[model samples]
Target: MEDNGNSTACCVKLADALMSMACMDLQLQSSIHLCASDNRLVPGKPLSPGSTIISDDGTFALGFFSPSNPKKHYYVGIWYNNIPKFTVVWVANRAAPITVPSSAVFTLTRSSNLTLSDGNGHVLWTTMAKSRISISSPRNTKNISTEAMLDNTGNLILRSLADNAIIWQSFDHPTDTLLPGMNLRLSHNTHPLQRLISWKDIRDPSPGPFSYGADPNNLLQRFIWHGSVPHRRSPVWNNYLLIGKYMNNLNSTIYMAINHDSDEVYMSFGMPTGPFSVLIRMKITYLGKSNISAWTTLYSEPVHDCNIYGYCGPNSYCDNTDAVPACKCLDGFEPREEERRTNNRSFLLGCRRRKALRCHHGNSFLTYPSMKVPDNFIYIHKRSFDECMVECRSNCSCVAYAYSNISSGIIDDTRCLLWTGELIDMEKGTMDGDKEIAVKRLGKGSAQGVVEFKNEMLQEIQRLTGQQGSR
Candidate 1:
């Protein structure tokens, strides 16, 4: 009976020991769960739903999100953590959204790549497994460890723990929003350009119909495209470093600069560097509008619908000086269909020259200051004003010529643009008023010098005004 009692005591001791171990295991799991919510993501650790990896500064968060409530689709995206409005800046699985949000897992793999998997262990999205560093030995490559980190700049980066070299970064592959410090590549001699593609809709993170990027054909300008067609065009870069400047609520100046290098050209914006710096972003809307928004709307390009590319058609310009911007024919041109203009129809018919060009007979150039130069220009390098005029005069097909002194140290000192055939996509009195100089072809006797040209144009304008007053 004593031996049986001892066995029972042993059984109770074993049960108590098992309970302590179970409690310790649960505590370890709870600690690991807390660590998973921090900025760094190590290999073997997976981030599931309801858990987010925030940036070190707590400015951005990376996690699974469903755009709408009754959640049918969910995507892994990075967004502002501090802001009340959840604004996603970058999306990882844009093309493939997970139907089961609860079953989704985002993990950094042993191979130094980030992988997103669905419930059934099917891979949804993965970072390209590209070696950023050269491995001297094959064995060393296998031993290299990696971790994924979310940065204060809203960039998700995967880096090697061995050398801390970046294997892949989300900033290199942008979505709709362009965060400050992210380069929008304008021109590259060899590399393919990157574009900011809009979301399919408010509820869908898939690529939409609208895209914003540099014009492939023209390196000096940018375009907002609707599929294959240009929806709007930015003013040609005048080789100025500062393209845009604005002020925030804090009275800090936000500067957008276009930087040039020997091999590439890119546009990037920056806000004041401080602890109280506000978030600034440029985003392309699903409907094809480009907006620069802070807490409130700061600026939007092509402010009016009439500012759309080719809206005024050929041989015309969009006049934005008035309260409501409207299309107007160039000085020497008139509407092709007067009836259409009067009936409030579209200007797709464009404009026609009031008189046909008679080459070199009595041709003179009419200066239109503060204008946006039309598209499809033939750029002539290093030409003086007189030389530019002579070159245009020599060509019978040349319709108009514009000359400007860039002197911005990166580009050519002088810009001599010659236009032939029809002129398209011109604007007047916009933000780039100082950069453009539109000179039109008119009647007989070209001016010999800049002073002479301005004088003659002034007298001609006064004469026209006098004639109108008398009538």
Candidate 2:
């Protein structure tokens, strides 16, 4: 219960003070320091470079950990407190875990900033922050009353007890996990769009090849990027929601919900109400596939089979419920190679066009439904299905189109995506399932109606003239 500085916040825990005690009461009387975990540090006990300093509220924890070798280097990290089986949501020194024992420590300076330093006082990692109120010359934060905390919602915040203001928070600088209320925004408006980057490997906490972000071009759908290519995609948004299908077997329905506030729009998921509380999370695996898992089940996932992204390659479909192992091409489409061989040993080479299109006035569209549509599409603003059809037919460059009615309050309150060239990584669904797409087939006879009309008119004129047969 003391006011040493003019600031308004209180320091909940001090590493120097806490290290002397085995446990301490978290309830602050006049002191305003407030993180939920009770942690103790000792001079002889340096946390073994692998344990944690958790808050009293069971919200966040600070610990030295490694997903890889037990005897290897250790990274300072923050993770959700209640979730079972350690899920490291944020890492302070992702690229620089401490290799040597007793060589690292986490501290808050006098100016209220958090930094991780090695034995020789070399800063391996630090949080990015700016002062809330400017001082005369930006005073160096020597030992200001600041602390690192993990919140109930899974945000690791670097805050000052002197003023009750957040200097920096992990919500703004996420590594891979995107909780219920976090904004994945533009880096500098000129960078190549910000995204959720996964780990290089399960055991390694470095940046990986897979990243998830909203499509900058349209921002209507979420995309999974591998390098710069479309690795996979979420369902196109409709009214800020995507309710895939009601599964009678699962006995549980899953759907996406979009929320918009003063700054950004974020997406989250929910399940049907039941006796068991179901919590869902999306994790992008090292093998480059996004998986959705439920908290209530032991190991039950709706779509964890073989068909995802382009696992089977282009134009090929994987039938999940088939008796023997299922992967095949559509009726009119043919495999790229005929002698490629059997199911288990062969990969999806995709389907090829049975016949070429003239792109002339004699083409017609063949509707192929029950599909998981292709990638690389641009959305057309506020267009109806019939209008979309006309627009595609009028343009020779356009190859395929898909439509979803979204009241998203963006341009037209409707979503219409178009593709110009190749159809890659598609699949077919069953009559009862919901991964349906309508594939358009443009053939030479596609424009036969207009051609037949013109030919008929020419013949009539020839008959009337009686000598114009050659023309």
Candidate 3:
């Protein structure tokens, strides 16, 4: 009887200890679940359809989202948490959406990858293939982990927990919106550039026709393209730093800046950091329009039809200074008679030169001040004003040339642009000041005329300098 009682007592103690351990394990798991709810995802913790990971500041949220129209296909995306409307900034599975939203799971694997898998164990999207995460672990033991977090600036970052190094981020893969602090790379020596591609339509988040990025041929300017054709073009970057500034109603200054390094040149915009600072974002819509949003359209591209690229056609310029912007031919050109007669003022047929050039005879250049230099120019480096003129004059194929001293704090260089063929996409009174000048070659076959014109240009330069000094 004593042995039996001792055995029973031992069994009871063992059961009680096991129960205590079970409760402690449950509590630990409960704490982990709570921690996962707040802005982060660790290994083995997956985000479901209804659940979301909000940013630390509650400014943005990352979760599954379905566009309003179909309401059937769901995608993992990041959107504004503070705003009333659901404005998605980035999408993870843009091309592949989940049909069964409830069965979709977004997980951060131990390999430091963010993956979205469906009910049947099919991966709709993953960061594993795109990024290579190097996690150090003990010999024969795989215990390394990673986490994904939504940042306050609307960036979704995947980082390794072992060393806390960022493996991948959503800012580098923008869909259609350009949030503050995000950059549009103008030039890079190695890394592939990113483009903001508009969604297919209002209801679909797939790729669209309109896309915006830096011009591959020229890094000095950016282009918004409709398929392969340029829809709109931004003004060339003359200065290496601050491009423009805007003053909001709250008296905060928003600045657009271009930054350059040894290997890269990128453009970004930022506002003052304070309580008065409002949420500002630039989005390219599906309808091929770019808008800066701050509860209102602060800035929009293609403000008028004249703002479109090559709107007035080749050999002509859009004159925006008038009450109604009009297309006008260059100084030594005239609109084609047939097209002008078809639509009296449209000038869609472009223009033709008034006379033909004689290469053997010397020519004089007609200078147009305060003009936006034409497109399709050949850039010549490290050339003086006289040298640029001689370069153009010597080349019989060169039709025109423009030279400017583009000496800024970051770059001390000159812009010597030579045009061999017909000039395209010129604008008048567009530059802020007398910054851009376009010189067109005229068929004046006199050597004395060329020398006299050069002297006149020198005198004009001195006069402009004197006026600037007075300022």
Best by lDDT: 1
Could you estimate the TM-score for every candidate?
0.82, 0.69, 0.81
lDDT of 2 by residue, 183-292 (tens): 66632334355577888887788888988878767665667788787766654554454454554434556655666644455556555553221234456656666555
Sort the candidates on lDDT, descending order.
1, 3, 2
- Candidate 1: stretches off by over 4 Å: 1-36, 131-144, 243-245, 248-250, 272-278, 338-341, 408-410, 446-471
Q: What order do candidates take by TM-score, descending?
A: 1, 3, 2
Query: Which one wins by lDDT: 2 or 3?
Result: 3
| Candidate 1 lDDT over residue span 128-191, tens digit each | 7775543343234344477789988888988877777888899888999899878888788897
lDDT to native, each model: 0.71, 0.55, 0.68
Q: In each prediction, how many residue pairs overlap at the backbone (N, C-alpha, C within less than 3 A)?
A: 1, 28, 0
**Tens digit per residue, CA lDDT, model 3, 330-400:** 77788887766665544677888888777753576776655667778888888888888888888888877
TM-score for candidate 2, residues paired by index: 0.69
